[model samples]
Target: MNSLPDLLRLLAVPAFAWVAWRDIATRRVPDRVWLPLLLVAGVALLFEFFTINGSPTRRFFLVRVGLSAGLVVPLSYAFWRLGGFGGADAKAFIVLSVLFPAYPAYRLLEFSFPGVETALGIFSLTIVTNAVLVGIFYPVALAARNALAGEVSLRSFVARPIPAADATTEYGRLLDVGPGRGGLDLDALRMYLRWRGHTLEELRADRSTYRHSRSLPEERNPPGDGAIRTTAA
Candidate 1:
């Protein structure tokens, strides 16, 4: 017979994998995706708690799970509030706290270390640590993609001038360039264009026509004065 812990571990693998995939694809995991896992895991833990018949190990396991939930949920919420984590990320960590309060008995690979075992006892910490370690590579990947696409030079990735035309279709804020650099404040540009009765479609269709009309924040002169230039990729 498979032990309760083993069975729970088996179920958690696919659940977490699905959450991970959804998060990658959509950048959001709906509550519907995590609710069932939380419910199932919570019920399983409760059942185990009552049925253990006064075993100290089982009691300790339950206590540890409770403590993990207490710590992880609030900490995740705090991160969400502070804008460090997305709502989906916070919810996923909270749910995983319930699902894997402690490490599984089965190891994916064996590494002998007392500290690892102790860390695994608060399994949610393991998830966060793993996530942070993985996240450290994201900027590198972004830099590589930008370099490959010629959006940025390999030698000076951080100093690359992103195209003003890229602002119309892309989803991020434009980098602020100082006065006299022919750089446009994207928000100000949009507002000025809108005030002059330009539609989004019109601006997108002829990005260059208005590129020279953009006003710098500190100096708004004639239409061509200190106008931002869009570089060709």
Candidate 2:
């Protein structure tokens, strides 16, 4: 009976691993990946409630699961709304809260928390913390790669100045100089210009007209080779 919790915890490991791998490779996790795990977790919780009679552990487990759901669901939704998390990422967090509401005792590196509740009781919080700690290295790795590639000069990397004209688009691709920031805001600019009965070509050709336009930066240079490069714009 004591081993029942351990068994349920062991069952969840592979399912979680599979979801993690799928998310890494494809940036998506299908319903099939988490649904069975959710079902199993539900069954395990019910089994523990009915079969484990000697302690208040079952009620405690229920409370942990409820707290995990209450805390994680709204947090995940908020992250999604803020554009910090995708739909798939939010769902994955919710599924994980159910599958691992508390820590399993049969795992490696067991330790006491002193005054702290066992780390497993707040499993979702640990997951978020671990993710954030791991993610902190990504920008460092990107900077290292850029330095090695010579895309980032040592002076530029160290100084990190706000440039008068950024040569590259937000996606890190080079662009011919025109209206630097305006290029990124082209759609809104286009609608405004069109509303004022001016075509983009007309604006590009007449520097005075381009400068006079509201909510638009003055075009610094003429169109390149008669092409309005809109890919990044």
Candidate 3:
């Protein structure tokens, strides 16, 4: 028969693994996984009380376990609210606290005298293993997905804008009529000016408005206005 601490350790180890796997694969750890582990930890504690001969120190350990479990609930809720940890991660963290109970100091795993050192070692090992798995498999999976999809290289999709002059020339080529094409047609320009509600003859009568009209100054304003206002030539 496994001792109380041994069984607790075993239960906790696999719970940690399941939580990590859930996060890595689907980025989720459901309550089903951690809730059972929490119950198992509780049962392990009850088993310890029944099987092991009591001493004041053992009773104190029981108290620590109770306090750890108690603290886990609120801490988990707070972390979930703050977005620091997901529900499953919170449950996993709670399980770790219950399993290890000594904060700031980790416990080294063993049947007797598990302390903060072991907890730290377990935490460190878990991190390393998760890192190694992600590093090895993620890139390979990405490459395979890209290959199956027949993804093109990024360079092929790059779009550099043509220079402004080149862009204008290309547009002109499409609309080209012939060499020495005359400037804007008077009738079309006049119709467009009327559409914009501009009166060409009225604009010509005013120096300020005529100068600012869209038509060229010589074409629309002309020298006639100044010529008629003679200052003895």
In candidate 1, which residue ranges exceed 4 Å CA deviation? 51-53, 107-116, 136-173, 176-202, 207-233
Clashing pairs in 3: 105-116, 106-115, 106-116, 106-117, 107-115, 107-116, 107-117, 107-118, 107-119, 108-118
- Which predicted model would earn the best lDDT? 1
**Worst ten-residue run, lDDT, model 3?**
224-233
Q: Rank candidates by lDDT, best first.
A: 1, 2, 3
The best candidate by TM-score is 1
Model 1, TM vs. native? 0.60
Evaluate residue 172 in candidate 3 and report its C-alpha lDDT on the 0 to 100 scale.
Answer: 14
Task: Return whichever of 2 and 3 wins on TM-score.
Answer: 2
Report the lDDT tens digits of candidate 2 across residue range 55-85.
Answer: 6776787788888888887888887898767
In candidate 3, what are the lDDT values of residues 1-78, reduced to their tens digit? 335555465756766776676565544456667677767766766666676566886777666666665665566667
Of candidates 3 and 2, the better by lDDT? 2
lDDT of 2 at 105: 50
Clashes of each: 0, 1, 10
Q: What TM-score, over all chains together, does every model reach?
A: 0.60, 0.56, 0.41
Query: Mind giving the per-residue lDDT tens digits that candidate 1 earns over 1-233?
Result: 34575576467678778777765543445678777887777876776677666689887887789788888888889978987678888888888888878765544356422235664488776777677677667667777877777776553333444565556433234445566565455545655654555645676687677566452235443333112333311
| CA-lDDT, candidates in order | 0.65, 0.60, 0.50
> Candidate 3 overall Cα lDDT vs. reference?
0.50
